[model samples]
Target: MTVSLDELMAALTRELKPEQFKDYCPNGLQVQGRAHIGRLVTGVTACQALIDAAIEQKADAILVHHGYFWRGEDAVLTGIKRRRIKTLMEHDVSLIAYHLPLDAHPELGNNVQLAKILGLNPGSALSRQNNHDMGLVAQLPAPMSGADFAALLAARLQREPLHIAGSEAPIRTVAWCTGAAQGYIEQAVAAGADAYISGEISEPTVHSAREHGIHYFAAGHHATERYGVQALGQLLAQRFDLQHQFIDIDNPV
Candidate 1:
């Protein structure tokens, strides 16, 4: 079954509510591709490689976590940006992106999906600013050693996480956010979390973890975030009965 790009965008915007967000990049249709979409491709970032793969698949629409026209970025499209837009326009493939909305969704969100995959039960938002913030406060089924918790994250994310054990206190409550959000560590502590998890680590983060008596884990950003957009794509695929494919372009960072 095929759906028009306008209809799909309207449905998605209504569901995701991209207009309500102050996101890093444009949340929908960064590049206008085809008018009628029969096949869809989903990925983490709208890089050249992912776009190429979508083109190869003959995808009419490409959905991703990161898209163009970021808040602070140059408005002028040139060089790599120019090429990327050119490719999408030439192929007539529509580009739709979701950032914080995808991360904050209860069922199809990145943080929720990460918790489910790692066997943690999410409780509430760690940050009060946005109930839909990517960071979440969760509780473990039972207390686990910091080492064991780190190992569990490693097993699921397929990367050796950087663990900074705070107090020898057993870990039961935790706060987590996917991608580079080390700044949220304090929010985790304020939320009464015994530990915090994010995608990247900074030098001060280690000290902050130790001083704050909260364990900190740095799982690979890309690894921790691969699930949400894929899940969203699957849902869209099933809803519209369109052919959908998820393209994984590995990023170590």
Candidate 2:
């Protein structure tokens, strides 16, 4: 079945609620394409490779977690940026993206998806200081060593996370936010998490985890985020009966 680009956007907007959160990029539709979309493609980022893949797949619209025109980025559309946009325009493929909104969606967001994959039951917002419910804290069913928890992440995420030692005790509580959210370890500490998991680890994160007495894990940014878009794609497929394909472009970082 086919749906109008605007209709698809409306469905996504109603589900994600982009206006609820302050995001770095535009949430709904980034590029205009043909009016009706029969084939929809989803991916983690709106990169050139994903665009090429979508075009090859004859996709009518592309939904993604990351899109262009990020806040504080270079305003000029030059080099690769120009090429990506030009290719989409030339092929008449719609580019729809959701950033912070996708991450925080209570049921379909990245955090919730990752928690489901890791078998971690989300309890509360990771940071109590703010109203933004981006990350989540989960008390484990049973306490396990930090090494064992890292191994579980490795098995589930298919990538060995960078583990930083902090507390000697087993990890009973973990707070996690997917995709370049290492800075939230402080919030995890404040939440009284025994360990914290995020996509990227900065230099200061090591010290923060150590000094705060919390274990830290740096799961791959791309690895941890692969599920949410796929889940969203499946939702679109089920809801609209549109042909949905999720293209995963491998990224080491």
Candidate 3:
């Protein structure tokens, strides 16, 4: 069973509501590719390599976390940007991206998936900025030592997490936002989280963690966010009966 690009975009827009967000890039159908999609590829970023892989697979569409036409990016398509768009257009492969909507979705969101993986019983949004909270605040099923918690995160995310143990106290309340959201530590603290976890960290994050008495974990940004898009791809694959593959591009930062 094949789904047209227009049909897929309509379903996704209805589910994600890209219009509701003030994102860095255009949310849906950044590049018009094939008219009909029989195979889909999903990834964290729409990099050149991923595009090439999709081309190799003869993918009808590429779905990703990062796409083009970002707020701060150069609008004119040239250089690497032009090349990426040209490749997709030449192959008639559609590019559909979801940014914040992917992050904030209750069931299929990055934060929610991360919380589930970390064994946290999510309660509410850690911050109240967007319509829904950007991150999740959850209660740990049982208290665990900071070291043990770090070990758990490392095991689940498959990256050595940067752990800043603030106090000797165990962690029972946790908050997390995926993908380089170190700035949200304060918000997590405000949410009364004993610990905060995100993908990347700054030097000052150590000082903030120690002073605030909140354990901080810098899990890999690429690692923490891999689940949401994969889940979304699976759903789309099942719903549309399209072949789907999740291509992972390793990023140290």
lDDT of each candidate versus the true structure: 0.88, 0.91, 0.90
Candidate 2: stretches off by over 4 Å:
128-132
Span of ten consecutive residues with least summed lDDT in model 2: 125-134
lDDT of 1 by residue, 183-204 (tens): 9999999899999999999999
Q: What TM-score, over all chains together, does every model reach?
A: 0.95, 0.97, 0.96
Better of 2 and 3 by lDDT: 2
CA deviation > 4 Å runs, candidate 3:
none
Distance from true location, Cα of 218 in model 1, Å = 0.9
How many clashing pairs per prediction, in order?
4, 0, 4
Clashing pairs in 3: 24-71, 33-92, 33-93, 34-92
- lDDT for model 3, please: 0.90
Q: Which is better, 1 or 3, measured by lDDT?
A: 3
